[model samples]
Target: MPLIKNVIHRFHVKRPLTARERELRLDIRKPAGDAPHYQLSLIRLNSTFVECVDKWYAERGFGAMFGAAAFSAVAFGMWVLVTNIFKHWHPIGLFFLLVFPVLLAVTAYIFLCDAFTYTHYPIRFNRKNRQVYAFRPDGTVLKAPWDRVYWTILGHANPLGWLNVAGHVMDESGKTVLETFALSVNSTSKQGEVKLRNHFEFFRLYMQEGPAVALQRIQPVPLIMLPPIDRQKESWAFGWERITLTLNGSPLLQILAQVFFLPESLFRWIVMRTSKIPQWPQWVEDECRIEPDDPWRREPGYRDEEAIAAMQATAGARRNG
Candidate 1:
């Protein structure tokens, strides 16, 4: 029982996100007009770590269960057909019957292991320097130039497309520098496509033609506000409140609520297993230690108009000089 307890503790214990982390995860907005640095929004499938793991397990379990049911139905039909035709047992029929249980068990075990073992890391994009910062839970920080990184939207056709943006980084010689697990944005609605496209274009333009050109290009698009789709709560009452507020009057949620009724404890357990806490890289730490100017620090409430005006004035001054 102690061994089982240990396993449960490792896989089922939940870690709650601090307010700051919660804010960071949910705040999906474009860079402020005046801020010198812009932080790319962190995308995730679920709000809490445990919830992500739970969803992972739930999805795999559902797939496995469906596959087993389909297989069993086909096998049963074949058995009936063979018995009616031959009036005796056949080797093929027996084989199908024997394999069904084994297949179900194997699929269940595989999905269970997957649910408990997978971990996700946070990837941050800095628009100012065109840099990507990947934080490992083990306190290691990996950095690369934006040009070295590549990204793809996995489910572009899906209405909730922001959940599909995935990326990885490579070295100058075309060697893989770091392999990132698929990360998803919080928005699961069709509107996410616009947000995803805007963000991608924002960075790409800035990197390709500097900030001035990028700003001009992005100016026409209205500001995007991507609020949290999944809310993490400490209790069932809180969860209910969140559901009512966030998912109120949605027919999809009504259907989902009926199909997958997740209790609070199970949701927490899954999040605890899958979520990874990000740590600051050693270089960032060292730089802050040596100087007061921390490059990674975000300027709160920075405005884009101010930045654009400043850039234009600098250009005009240079031309006159």
Candidate 2:
């Protein structure tokens, strides 16, 4: 098989080590005369479908809690206004009756969107069949038959299900490797570790022909978000053909539900009502923003203007002394 010219090499990004460092890292040895047996492929293990589902539900809870609080405050304000208008009648009771239903509806919608569908899955290439598979957390496989596959898109980095869900079928075969957001590697918590292990096992069992003993040279792609969360436009990788799955309905629906707040709310109500204890808190303070203060620069990336000024002043004083 002809290798692509743009092969991603780990050494390219990693700092080159001296003889001793190389030995320390991997016991330095001369390259074998023969070419490496299998082509190396990178598989990033983030969160499993189950974890993502849980996280989505947790977020829905927060949203509903926040929304409920806001709505209740507003309703109270309205009640006060109506009381002033009709001092003896107590019209505030009627106001509560009207407003409670609307608040309930909003909360219900949030639950549906958060619970019903799949999002954040790891996509794998099956070299033997030359197809793709979206590995779900439950061990159910979404297989992309060769005939259905469109060309695989290379590099877009939003972890949420944007173009991540669309499956383009091949024009000639009429088959598509259709999968929506199923697995994600974004969360690095304990749950995330379990999900990564699941994917690693899946790839080990399934990816027979690709690469060496273990997948290597994995790097984290920076996270991006679906629209309405950011001013940036929504993104996707479009396959040339329509997706084919045993399951009916557009995978795009899953993408929409996971990315935006309103659709997510509706998705949760439909999918999560009967379920108990869906998911737990996902947002850790450390991950919310990049850290700036550090030994390296007194700021992340060594680029704080104030820190630079302070350092310059200290250096000048030291020189005078």
Candidate 3:
């Protein structure tokens, strides 16, 4: 049983990063210089392709467990209703009975689908060159002009205010060239909010005021609030085809697709485990690299002395007035 558990653990869990990998890995907190170029630290184990594969498998297993638990809970509840109240079926119970299955099935299908489809390509921003590059897992690269990129924040206002910073590059006709998943930030506390605002301000300044203007320490513009209508439109624009087909199409077909795709996803997972990930090109390495020590790097809510003084003065004035 110990041996079996060890094997299962190896298959399902990612190994921790080596000392050398940790030393060399980019830290997103310390953006290189005060310039408009920055790269978000890779999610999970990104040092090697093998580690990434392990992380993927682990994620899939956890996802499956969660989905199963949800489905089973719903199913059991419905079963109890059917057995106990067969003659006096309540409308709410009947509604749940009908809706829960579809919801669970759809949820399961999405959960499984993500296990295969989710890809985390490294993204870099270069305000100087007016370019954005995404290094794909397959050794290919996607590049887009800065002007063509559109960015928005997807966040909820709560005690632990979490934000997802997402963007996409589009052509003149508004066709998407490349899109990035949210680089999540926790903004629940005052410090977290400052960090989130700083990062957002960096991008906003570069885009609106240009690199030269951004170089100067100007006050940050308030983060824009995306309306529900706009958020819905963005969602539709991002993955409308897949979403529409999955929701509107035959349930039978959905189940069949899930069944068939399982093997393929498993095969890919196996391949990723066995094969080595290619090393990034020298150009990409240089472009995306983060420096260890940058003057601009600071703890959340702690600005440089000059900025701190200015902020304090402003707050004092507001209180006095």
Q: What local distance difference test score does each model get?
A: 0.40, 0.32, 0.41
Q: Which stretches of candidate 2 lie over 4 Å from their true place?
A: 1-100, 115-142, 151-214, 219-321
lDDT (10s digit) by residue, model 3, range 1-321: 223112211111123323432333223334322433112221211111100111122122334445555777777876787786678767787777788778777555534433333232344455445566655434466567656554444344467544434444445565432333333233444344345455555555554444344435434321111222111212222222222232234777656665534443453343333333334468755754434553322221222366557777888999999
lDDT of candidate 1 over 1-321, digit per residue (tens): 223112211211123322422232211234412322112232221111101111122122233234444556656665665566456656776776666566655544433432333233345445545565655334355566655554544333455432433444444454342443233333466565455445455545455555455545654332221122123212334333333333445867755764443442244344434433334556753432322454322232224465567677887999999
TM-score of each: 0.42, 0.30, 0.37
Winning candidate number (lDDT): 3
* Preferred candidate (lDDT higher): 2 or 3: 3
Better of 1 and 2 by lDDT: 1
Top TM-score model:
1
Report the C-alpha lDDT of model 2 over 1-321, residue by residue, as the tens digit. 111111110011122223432222211122211212111112222211101121121233334335445556666766675666555565666776577667656544543332332332234444444455543434344456533433221123345422111223323333322223322222324333333333333333324423332223221111111212111111221100111111125677644444353443443343334223211123321222322442211111122355456667887999999
Which prediction has more favorable lDDT, 1 or 3? 3
What candidate 1 gets wrong by more than 4 Å, as runs, is 1-106, 126-130, 135-142, 155-163, 168-183, 186-192, 199-258, 261-268, 271-321
